[model samples]
Target: MGKLYGQPDRRPTAHPARPLVVDSQFSTTSVNNRVLVYQVPVNKKRPLLTISGIMSADFLPNVDPQQVMIGPAYAHPEAWVYLPLVNPSNLPRKMIVDLDHNRCDTLDAFLLRGQQRELVHLGTLFRRMPLVQRAIPVRAFALPFELAPHDSAGLLLRSRRSTGIHELTIALSTEKQFTIKRDEEESIRLVALSSAFFFMFTVFSLGLIFKHRLLIYFGLYVFPIGLGQLNYNYFFDAFPFPAWLGLNANSIGLFIIFATNCLFHTFGVAYIKSLNVYGRWHRYAVLFLVGANLIPMGLLLFPLTRTTNAMVTNASLILTTLNIGWLFYISMLGFRVKREKYLLITATLVFVPILYRTYVLDSPALSYSYFQPFYYLLLFGYLIVSLFRRELISQQMTEEKIRLVQGKLEMLRKSEIEQIGRNLHDQLGNTLASALGYLNLKEPRIQVARDMILDAINETRVISHNLVKDDNRPLDEKLEDLAERFNDFSTISFAYSDYTEKRINQLPLLKQQGIYLIVQEVLNNVVKHSQAKEVTIQAFLSEDVVRVSIEDDGIGYTPNQPTSGIGMANMYKRAELARLKLSIDGSVSGTSVTIETPLGG
Candidate 1:
């Protein structure tokens, strides 16, 4: 008998139990027991393949067959299965048999319940053969056959031909593919944008700490938390770290976030408590939250024992929840206080969505990507508002100080005017009256007496006129007049220099009077107290300020020694009123009083 082989044209048939078959022709030959394998391609484009057992040798009647097999079997566009045959004898034998195929798609259909039933296709195939034929397209086919002993062959035949026949089976399933929807992608994009915005805002907010130091210390703590939250979400996926390291980073980051939140909360609580908005209980609550949140961070660093992962998560949740509740409470309190309403409203609006996203929605996309940035922005806004308010308060304080100084100066001016009036009436007026009475008394040198009396009267008149004059005259003119008047004494030599006419004229009348008084007092002290031989008054002006120096060549008196008069005290008081600075530098050689006043004054 020729080699028992079928042509390559064996069309594939769709049979649920046996979807593919290549039956061998009967051959009685003394050929060595050889097994032939067939390569069949299973179609994946159709349905999944369900494969089962091989036909037994006993299933063929009056045939001395070895064993039957199929494969280099390949299942397609999805998977592949291999079928093999074994021979007991060295001689090859082939048996005639009819290859049965059946469409058994409903094999497990009865077993499915409820929703599983929907997996079945709605339509039926017109031709079963086309399904299988389309499934396996390869041409080359072979089957393994083996010779068996008569007893074994007869047993296999009986088993195969029995009423209860067994068959190989396999189940196949198609996987459903899913794609991201537009809204999902949009959400992701929004999250990314929000995260980036907050990250930048956090950086700017942190910068404010340096720009506005003491006032923005709160921002220093707050910005770091914002950054931590941003980094935790945005960088986690992209960070090139090991799993444990990533988790550690995340834990540390979250620790910072909670820590900052606690810091801000505690600060807020303390600040509000200071305003008497909340009771001591509110402060205690803040302290408790702060302590709880800090425990993990402290443990993470050193000395303290490290917190367990579970404890950290639990503590963070508790702290966050309490903080959110407290924030709402404080906001309500703020509304009642009627002050800081804007801050309260802004913080509430900014943080509520974040809290909801965090605890309620549990959306990372919302928390890190969107809410964090918005939070930072709101924090920055708060800082700006705080700074502006602080500046306004500072300005008001400065104005109040200025007003107080002005009132004191006005009082001093009134007192000085009264004292000057008293001195002119008691000293100069009385001296002139005595000189007039002496002139009226007749004497042998009545002419000489009349001349002396006339001189004294003129002197008194000059003093009266000088006192009444604007005294707004240039410093040089004033100093010249003073020097000439002092020169009349003959014993005193007065000299002056380095005077700017325009600068002296530009000085405020009160400030000029201050300088003039300081000069006059120094001269009087030198002439009377120091018994000075010569006196020199010098004035100089620079772009920003003026300097007046009055030097008397006299025996210098030690500073702090109680003077025989109130000249020094009066000078100091006048300088204070005019806001001028005075320094008396003196020694045995001379006494120099240097007075500095702002030029425009």
Candidate 2:
């Protein structure tokens, strides 16, 4: 008993089982070969319609007469299979072998005909084995030949020695019901359509809640699904290339399948999170899934860890499928939660068909399967659900913010009252105290008291005026009055404009006050420090914006030098409160300050 005898109980799987051409031991014993002859069972006057099964064989002392076993026992990735289709008809007939699996890492097949076991050259059928070697686009592989009556041809499958489920399907149909793939052209067209479909999906995903990790993962899922399944069938048919190139094309497509599956599971976790789905073990489960999915990619992508055949990589798919299936199960867990329910439904709709396609069906008879469109539909559904969930969360957050702002506003009001109290005590208390000291009975002292008391009165008026200004007064009128006071007091003549009278009145009182203070601060600086001969203050309005500018022809102070006055800093605080922009630029000749305010506020 050898690799072929690794089968359980030696009961053949299904009636038309694939037989081992050679039987021998694999590990401990090798170099033994035995042949199993078969009489082609004529079906309804036609020869065998299909012959298919799994074959397990070893690499040591490789002897030919390739034997194929019938059972699930030898379904190991490292094990290889041998498929020989014998023709028992009196006349030549076309034989077709439709392989179910992407037969990998195999050499060209051979023809062993008659008792002499005459070896004949295999026709061009398996010549491009290298180029078309990949299991990517799970192709509809059919080995067709015109076998002379009583002729038998076989395929030698030396699958890559790796760990994972590895098997093949061999379908043979005699002349009567046999026909070339009817949808071959359409299938190729479908393969070509992948680019267009992928592009559209990418654009759509970008347009919708792109910031959301869910959309990002969905995009990740879609890209590989489209790129990997792009078998070289259409491209090569239209513009034939070298055999090696074809083989690479297949390999790349195959790589895409596993990679896409891994990424797809990540997208599932993102979906769960977006729906706010949670369980004690949910994150742990998802993290575990992510780790498992990445195993294959880590091994294959990292050059140092990769093997030539990468048969172990097949386990990646098994783990990936299990992870994906687990994700589906998790989605079901969310069924009771309303929001999560929709996400789950959409996920189910998306993944169920995928599971079906992977586990049950063959490569479609159509131009690619309709699975992509279904995937797109599901991806889009998830996108919409994600966006809706995000918006709902945003609304909740906004309400929370409003409550916080109300509390902050109340605190601001209390601070403002405290500020007014300090201003009154600091400014008025000192002047009143000084006036009280001058109050004496003597005539000279009485005169001093009269002067001091008058001074105190003036100080009281100034403090009151500053603390309480009628903000409703038009901004331009206030500026006009400012110009009058400055021009009368300062040595420098003042030039002013009032173009903002209409626009400035439309703004909020707080904003108008802020603008007014900025202008006042700028002018006061000019009077105290600048030795200017002339000054210009302008209030200009344009649409929604009002600009106040004050310029001095005085010796400008250096910006790098700090001033002891809080007047400028006070002006900045006011501008910040009102959301206005204040700028001050100075040179050797003078200083210019501009306060720009928006009327819409």
Candidate 3:
């Protein structure tokens, strides 16, 4: 017998119960005619290169191709199967050859003619076979072949470079059987794609409604993710575009996938850390991860080749490790800052499976099977629900704040009415009574009674003016004017001083008015009850707050005692309403009332 190429000079032996033969040689050819052609020694270390038993159309589907060991013998990055098939029929027949591997990049076949004991290639049966040879998304390449009686041919199945594990499976069937199988598989893929799209749409709609950028980022991320998955699963084989666009669909799809994926991570980290929840080191680490993720995308700019593909794969593996480590690190930091815990947990939980499916199990950072799209759908659902919950919580908090403000306003209104009533009765009623008593005296002192009646009228005017005072003036001017009015009312010497005049004037108009009212009430108490000979109004700044203090050299009362004075009570209530702090310190020499207001508020 003639010696075959890369085979021992002996007749190829067939199994007793099977018609399959072994040539003790294997070769993998690239589309550009680059070959990693080598021979596998017929020893225990060599894996089964060909299937045993009768190679019939019915039995081909059940034949499982052994895995190509990726050791020193087959160390090249690019690999595929070079299976030899024999025609076992006496009658000439036409058959459809199908290579069913989702991760396959290309598939082709060529006829083999026998010369002595060797098999030689005749001509190309097909080259760079289309992935979608059918009308649907079934990931199989089917080609029609005509075989003479007892003639043989070899099927060439080419797959992308295997970074870790690799396997191949082949099927031979009639044209009708291939159509039926393709249709059946197409239905399953369609359902998966539809479900993935539904989730994507739901997430995008929620993002539009809420206008949350986190959800929007996620929605955009899913688009390229779906494309990358389709590309990885050989869906792009049927619609191969020319490289005139600088990059084909495969490379472009992968580029977008990694780019968008990195953007998602960057944006997510930014959104969560927008409040400055994490520290500078965490941000620096994130920047490093971003740079690492970007390196792989830059590598895609090179032409798609075995070496370039391997480089991209190694870079992606590094990125995957960095991403996983970064997630765990961020999760650790998330525990320290409670606000980000939910976000960290959700992201880590959702992305763990996705990264595993994309990088660890399937292709790294590029392609995935049909099942991977649904993982994105799951992530989308999580983001939508989280945003809704946050919105609901924010709405509830706003409503609660409004209700509390209303209640405070009601209390302030009633307190003001009582204070006014007390002032009227205490000042006007007493003056009128004194005047009547003097006029009804036996001597009828008309001049003295007239003076008393005039005093009562003046008191009424003062009360009316205090009820509606002009508030457009600056706060320091208002304070000085108040002190002047109080000095006119009583013999208590009034002095106005402002050390932080600019700061006081910068306060909001509402706050200035509130401070003015509080000071008026405090001085009123000093005139009516304290019998103070001197009073000083002072304004100053204290640690992030503005303080207005009214000190009187009056008979001070006990601090804890419940006073019946409406002026003191109203002062406290007004301070509470204005969101200011009020404190009164009384000593044997004097009483000091201070109103402390936040500078920012």
Candidate 4:
């Protein structure tokens, strides 16, 4: 139990303990297990420190401890350094580990101290860190070390580095200041909370509204994007799903993100009310995005080789960059077509920081600081914009419907006025003229004048009754009247067939009105243009749908041939407002028009 200080003047005893097994879960091979112990002498004197820079990886397997003290230092790409310290006083000690690697790939620190059971456990000197936007962290760290029989035990630290020329600073001190904590990581919880809020907002918007296509697609897109942040930010580390979801979780998140990108591009190009604006080129771009999204599946099938890694990297780089470029292009299109400047600007402002955070400054650890405020705010903006657009489109549809309904009412008023004008000009005027003739002829025929007066009175009563009535006339009665009035010496006959009483009354009021107007226009077309001798109107109900059709036996024109008169346009517009599907078929033999509408509450 004799001890030597300042250096390892005593080789390890035969009963000395071996080093503990280093945990390497993902590694393919085993490591050499050799433990070295050194004893430092106690002194009320100044502290001691020893520092060395490693020049090559070869130095680790075979090392001359004496030669290591005298080796010349040269500036090189990667250095594995050995730093040892001896605390020789009967008090607590402190150490600082300062590393600077601008082009860093990986840094592993092993801090070893001796134990009675024949193994040494490494102290966690530094948490796992990944280079984010900043190439190098601008801070250093101070850590505490304690040992039993406090004065004479030493600590050993081995650092392996893989980077260009860099510096390492290890110091032994008696102070209590540690500067390893970063200000950015402190608010990690806040960022996570913000992400959660945005994520829930997207879900709420999706569940609340289905009136717009943008909302549906945008909601779907937000799902993978938000979860990807949580997953990459290490939020899932505490969750049980990651045990089974490991690796596959990341893979699936990436797949969904890619698919959402494709969907967003597609929906962005051709969304509600803007379907006519997206052309063949836009469709082709959407197809290209879909193909791009499928690239991640390749990782599942192949054992990754150098070529596969290169391919995957290229695909990811291309698609990720293209997502931004595609959005910019859409913004330009939106400005021209929809004047959606806020949509583009807010999106760009919101997403640019996200791009920097995601693509530039990704950390290996799920540190709270990994979640950025801009990413969450950007997502919130998207949700707001989607809902805003949905609301605008809904209002537009409602107003259009109101305008169409107003037109229908106006058309109904005009028809009634025209019929009243015809009755007064022909029937009532003729009867009054006959009464005047009975008096002017000097016949003094009181009974004949009385008869004419009664007829005139009845005509006035019918006109007044038709004008004041608000209830609907039966379809059959209206058709009979239309036939009698338009019968030019029996030149044309009206044939009408309708659904049963139960089904007919089940039709909505607006739907019935639309059908009646549409039929009236069809009969008028037959009279004015078809030279038709017979016109037939039919209606029926089938499978929760109500259908109305009109047919004529005369010369017929093609259906939807743009040159059709204003009456046809009115019928088409009315049918649209009523949510009815309309079609017309015309040929030399005859013409037929039909409309079908769903029954609704």
C-alpha TM-score for every candidate: 0.33, 0.43, 0.55, 0.45
Q: List RMSD in Å for every model shown.
A: 27.9, 19.1, 11.5, 17.3
User: Ten-residue segment with the worst summed lDDT in candidate 4?
Assistant: 66-75
81-195 per-residue lDDT for model 2 (tens digits): 3345555546566544443333332322345555555555343223234335432122344445556655565543332312222333334453333343425534554744565
Residue range 115-209, candidate 3, lDDT tens digits: 33233332222223543434223455556665566766554443442222232345555556667766775776666666656665766676677
Q: Choose the strongest candidate by TM-score.
A: 3
lDDT of 1 by residue, 395-461 (tens): 6796797798678767766765675566557655676666666667765455665665665555454
Between candidates 1 and 3, name the one with more favorable TM-score.
Answer: 3
Could you give candidate 4's per-residue lDDT for residues 89-183 as a string of tens digits?
Answer: 44444443333221222334444344322224333323233223222333222234443334333334443322111223333332223332334
> What lDDT does each candidate get?
0.47, 0.51, 0.58, 0.50
lDDT score for residue 207 of model 4: 41
TM-score, prediction 2: 0.43
Predictions ranked by lDDT, top down?
3, 2, 4, 1
Q: Kindly report which residue stretches of model 2 are placed more than 4 angstroms away from their true locations once superposed.
A: 1-103, 115-117, 123-144, 149-164, 171-200, 207-213, 231-258, 261-273, 276-288, 302-318, 329-334, 346-601
- The lDDT, on a scale of 0 to 1, for candidate 2 is 0.51
- Total clashes in model 2, counting residue pairs 3 or more apart in sequence or in different chains: 15
The backbone clash count of each candidate, in order, is 17, 15, 0, 3
Q: Regarding TM-score, does 1 or 2 come out ahead? A: 2
Error at 555, model 4, angstroms? 20
